[model samples]
Target: MEKRVKERREGLPELPNAEKGKVILRFAPNPNGPLSFGHGRGVVINSQYAETYDGKLILRFDDTDTSRKPPLPLAYEQIPEEIEWLAGFKPHLTIMASDRIEVYYEHAVKMLKMGAGYICTCSADEFKQFRVAKSNCPCRDNSSEKNMQGWEKMLDGTYSPGDAVVRVKTDMANKNPALRDWPAFRMQDTITNPHPRKEIGSKYRVWPLLDFQSAVEDHLQGVTHIIRGKDLMDSTRKQVLLYEHFNWEYPETIYWGRVKVHEFGGFSTSEMRKDIEAGIWSGWDDPCLPTMATLRRRGIDPIAFRDFWIELGLTQKDIAVPLSSLFAHNTKKIDATAPRLSFVRNPDAISVGIDADERMSSISVKSHPKEDIGMRKISFDWNERGTDIYIENEDSTANADIGMRLKDWCDIGPIAEGFSQMTSLEPATELAKIHWVAKGGASPATLMRPEGKQLHTIEGLLENHDFPIGTIVQLERVGYARIEKDGNLIYTHD
Candidate 1:
């Protein structure tokens, strides 16, 4: 436990620009899918910075791209729950882009009237040709009045999905072609792919693009800083164009590089959703996906996630860590609390004929070895002759010379091939001490381990186990496990 936590002895990076009780940071994630480790790292740093400065943290859901990544209604609620679970409190504010479409629309109109934007009706193919030539679209020189008419047509259902779009005016000859006449808003046929909000229910067809919507909301919400990935440097630049157009100050920004968590290569929530729909995955909380929901379901403590990101600190270098890096942190938290239990997978019987009932009752072990955690009483029921001790298959031996001991129980010699025999009770001296269930009301169990996004089940029996569901236990020789709400035992990790 000490080793997992003590490596980070230095202090975290200071937010020099943040003022006490005045700094405001926002974690703006698109609500189109579940949050990933990449998304969590951004939000955790933003929230931590907010706490470090005694300021406010806002959870703003950027749900603008309904045409491509439609806003998942469940995510709007789950995202906040996850954030609160991680930060240990509710954010100072929660804003959804869907709820603030009017504000975005107002700003887009303001830019149009300021002659900083125009409506371009160029076909995608034609726009590509113009972009390649570094030439302006035909409508680039149109008056604000004509652009206003096109915008009205886009909103009032007069335009089809691809008929018209609002473009923020930028250099046509810009080296980065993406900055040339970037589209600020576009027409989407909501009837075909509707927004999930039932109240809105396809009422609006003109939607602001993500870059445009976030810039407007940031200024309105008094955001002091932006924490995001270096891949989004282009996004920051795009938002800056609108920020400058409105004479709004761009917030101080800290950009991090992409992180690669091993065992999750090519993981995508959108693709995972389609796979889930096609029955390729179990579901979002499948214990294999890197989503927060899966992490929580697998009994991953939220504090581990917090510490994991905090330890990563404010480095811009891309980090590639194994799943064990996270499990190590989680194990430190649970090692003291998880009770010790014995599970015999594919039971191999070793019949030890003991002397008396007193010897049979000598086996005892605590819930946790050194901690003050409660203990589980272990008692062995007697057959007509003696006690029937059941141990693991690999631990059984046919030789009577080599001594073996039951864990914290009694020392016993292995019986011969055709004879059930007994040895004198002595202090255990063998190097191999095996765990066993005395066949005294041991409960039938199945340990489910997640092996590369698939479930690997071990049919087994747990010894001296009488805990209710949801009780986490360390299966003596096996890894830690959580008794799920469904009464199934699922392995957390070593």
Candidate 2:
């Protein structure tokens, strides 16, 4: 299996210009909500490279867009926790961009004084026209001193939101208009849209965009490598230009094509947040959501989750995969230790009459088929006629005529009343093997199965076992599930 995975991944390539114990990698995420499956790729890939080189991994929160993509207060704590869970270690340094507004302001002032940045009072429409015409905006020719004056106005109340923006001086004739003079800093109305952080709430209105903030942060942190999605290549192009202005060496960048998990393709942090506000989901850890918390709640081993992405490696070709791929990895990691139990959904009761000589009072079954995990004894209550047991409704009458083996117990066949015990302990080869729980040993259970956006519940009876809460167990014919509570089980996967 290891060999197959290596061949499939083609092995992760060594980082360029990387030195042992010198490489520094970072995973920057917008802290709007808990990290989802899409975000895990960055965390895993960057952390893996950091580990391979014995380097430092930094967790940076790009939470400066207080108005457009406001940072959720809870996400401040959730992102680091999720990263630690996925990476198997806490980052060497955790920095929040919101905490360093003054640093960004200092850089902005330096850029303006160096004649590489200008404050533009042009409306968005006016700038778009200039960009489309491949011509410079009027503000491009402003003197550094004049731009600094406008910058002060932006920091104060003189320039309202959208009335002024600081633009990075780039070529207006650049083939890609988006690569033209892009907005680096803008004024925001903190009064109406205050930042979630109490200390930083409405502190200042002038804010730096992602490109400016991230570029400066990466340089300051001495990041040696950056692993980001291919969609952000334009960000790299823009940042490279900014680096040229500062005469800074840009980090080696690696890009992976978008990985669209078939099950979670429709999920977005913003949309999920809106739904969560409307009470559409239970919370970030809801069973149906594709969040790290949800996966942890469903009993997905963190090692398996990490291995799943590591095996995928890095590629530029966009790939779509099903959730089953991850489930397969998880099964291998947990199956050997997951206890086997009987859970009959939509249970149907049946009485099995037994001959006096064939009476079996109790049956002991191994909790694990191939391991010495101990045994569970299921006792039967016998009457003058027969003993009662419960089996899945679908399996009750399917092979009555041919008879069926009550797993770990004797064989039984249809009779006038219900079923009659067979004399032979070993059933015929063609006989169906069905799981059953003696009436006395059955406990009510509810199995929650997540199918896309909907969570379905299956009422059933689980064999009375001593497995503690959070235990991952495999139901005979059903799939693997986690014991959420006394009578609750959340289905993980088949």
Candidate 3:
């Protein structure tokens, strides 16, 4: 296993400040939706660094906010599967913020007693005015003793949703407006957005914001480094202040700019949820979406996804990467193992007539021409007449009585509408080379290819349907495809 990881991680740039003791990292994701290719980067980088230092990796589900970004039950399990698929390793630990509610409460009380936090009952509009004016609110001046009473009121059900919150006492005049006494905890409207975890989601009304929860978890979980997107730099800054207020040292942090995959649209968990709920998408694994499930279903090698990010490394500037390059990388890894088959899309047929011959019953053809991928045999069941075969319209000759070869099968007369076959196994050198599949030897196959923002279905037929479904194969003259268990296909790439 160690050697496997090392082999997959070769040629990566050295991490900065590599000597941190017992390097511990955590990939804390909110379980609102299945992870996308963008999430793959964080999983691979953190896992690689942890392995590099012989440390541990944690999969922490930051599921505190059950109101706005409510958790999806499937996301809880789907995320880890995606991570393991991309990184080829499992996390050593799994944790949920909702499970650690009591711990956060204890920390919140401590902050309240320390005078670093206070309970504010201001309405949303009032807080916006205070933020715009860069001024303090009436709650900001409350003593710790008075704040303690308000805190009790919050816990005793005296405060309704949006009626009160606990805010950390940051500088009111800080240059960044977000830093000015941000709310630490708020009351969730459990009626509108019920918690996903029926056992505990609705049990608590007051919850810590992501900033406070993440900061506390980092310290308590023994995290040594934080790797995240540059867009979250503000989050990093906010967490730093929490670390300071608690008189604790902050963890090492690294931020990289956003990565744009040219083939996919941007990601949004809420948007995905809305689409799924509205039946706009089949599911997270729908070919039109770039979610990990869809990518896996397309027969893409996980190693290809891992290498793409590792080679890109941690850069400050955002990158616009073409998805074709990733397909190119995956092809190299699977070309030798991916078996080949014959597929005729929009098939055109012709009946070749010939005399009885033992050689006409079967023919052997290499699955892959240049590689030692073995071979497949195509057979004809009859001899009185010639073999009936089908070919993709695009690969068919427009003229009849013209000389043509039936791919690895046999020599044929001109490609026409009726049955006509050659008496010999040899074809003229000038015969047109066209892909053909013997009738009844191939099964109906449908290929779903992803377009800009929708899925396009193309009907076709595969010569060897006996191969187990879910097998990844290259259609001799066509692109690669992953056969569905039912014999359909999801096109990977050309």
Candidate 4:
């Protein structure tokens, strides 16, 4: 079953109306923070389709909302860097909505002149009553000239925040009340809540809502296809209405259901930002978090992410998966090259007696069991009587009467006061295979594992080697880890 799954090609379903070299897709993230694991699905699917069709992928920052979900300053650069890291190439085109405020404004004026939109001065409660009654607010019947004057008031700060808003004209009696004259643009007090961008700070009091901004940009950029979540189908409906007002064609859109990674369920970028500010987490790259930066720092290959998502394919059915499912893909990508080493946690010393003439002083084992990656030698502190080795304290307390084998080294008969070395290299019968390091031949190291919002550090002794920082190595009987600059290890997976 596993082999069949692996044999399947890693690609997404063919996009509808997609043409080779002409299919243009986009990934427009709000840039509230760095990309999360949920965001990765969109990135990978769009990137894979773009590559498959030999088309262009545009990275657009949909950062028009400055009051509710404000954009972070560092995200402008961090998001692009992450996209490059994951896709192995930069996006063909990059755009920021905040910088295109003028374009959105121009479209607003055009919509007003054509009587497709009107400025409403109704309060939130009054608008809700009107929408509930399937009726139009008093401002909805104003003439185009009157609406234009209201729009000018909005731009010139004549209307305070929430005093007036531009609403796109849609059917008031429409069954879905949300579609009835949805908000197109609103006023934001730039002094109390300024945009993060220096060039955009307090420059314009009127800001376009997401539905309006994204619709205009999609049409302007000639986006051929749009892939978004099913929750935003209403936004698509709203945008389609606006598209009709301009007599422009709406792009082919595909919607996917929410994917709930069991480990990162219910984690939002806003909550993460607050936690990070409170110092509950280190930063975006904190291993405990599920941000792309954290995944990269933990040594997950970009290919693994790509393959994982492509295998899931495009679906509207909501799916749930464990993090280990992703680790399985990474293990396949890295196992062949990750060198094997020994690590003993909570080590306890045990002496094994060997005859001077029959025992070897050291043993050299293949760095990888099935690969020609070279050999690593384990030196023993052999005296005239015996050699001392360190094993995990848990192993020392285990049943040792049957005997055990020091992996890749030698077999031991039994444990009385100490262990008695057996003559045979291989055990005659089944025995516990233990991973050990020669005393004085290992360095003290710490393995940090992220477990349920907490980072647990296990102090251990790792076999001495000059493995470069960022090298992923499998510790014998232990899981894989990436070597850190300080000679510690960050646990990757089992």
Error of 2 at 390 (Å): 0.1
lDDT assessment of candidate 2? 0.90
Single out the weakest 10-residue window by summed lDDT for candidate 3: 1-10
lDDT of 1 by residue, 362-392 (tens): 4556788899887777776666656776777
RMSD in angstroms between candidate 3 and the native structure over all alpha carbons: 4.4
Worst 10 residues of 1 by lDDT: 417-426
Q: Which residue pairs collide in model 3, if any?
A: 351-419, 352-420, 353-420, 353-421, 401-414, 402-414
- TM-score preference between candidates 2 and 3, better one: 2
In model 4, where do residues sit more than 4 Å from their true spots? 1-10, 358-361, 417-423
Off by over 4 Å in 3: 1-11, 397-402, 423-432
TM-score of each: 0.94, 0.96, 0.93, 0.95
How would you encode candidate 2's per-residue C-alpha lDDT over 402-425 as one tens digit per residue? 678888887877633465666467
Best by the TM-score measure: 2
lDDT of each: 0.80, 0.90, 0.82, 0.89
**Model 2: residues >4 Å from true position, as ranges?**
1-10, 356-361
Candidate 4 structure quality by residue, lDDT tens digits, 359-429: 67678999999999989988787776688888887876684676678888878777767656664676655
Clashes of each: 0, 0, 6, 0
Candidate 2, pairs of clashing residues? none
RMSD to true structure for each model, in Å: 3.5, 2.6, 4.4, 2.8
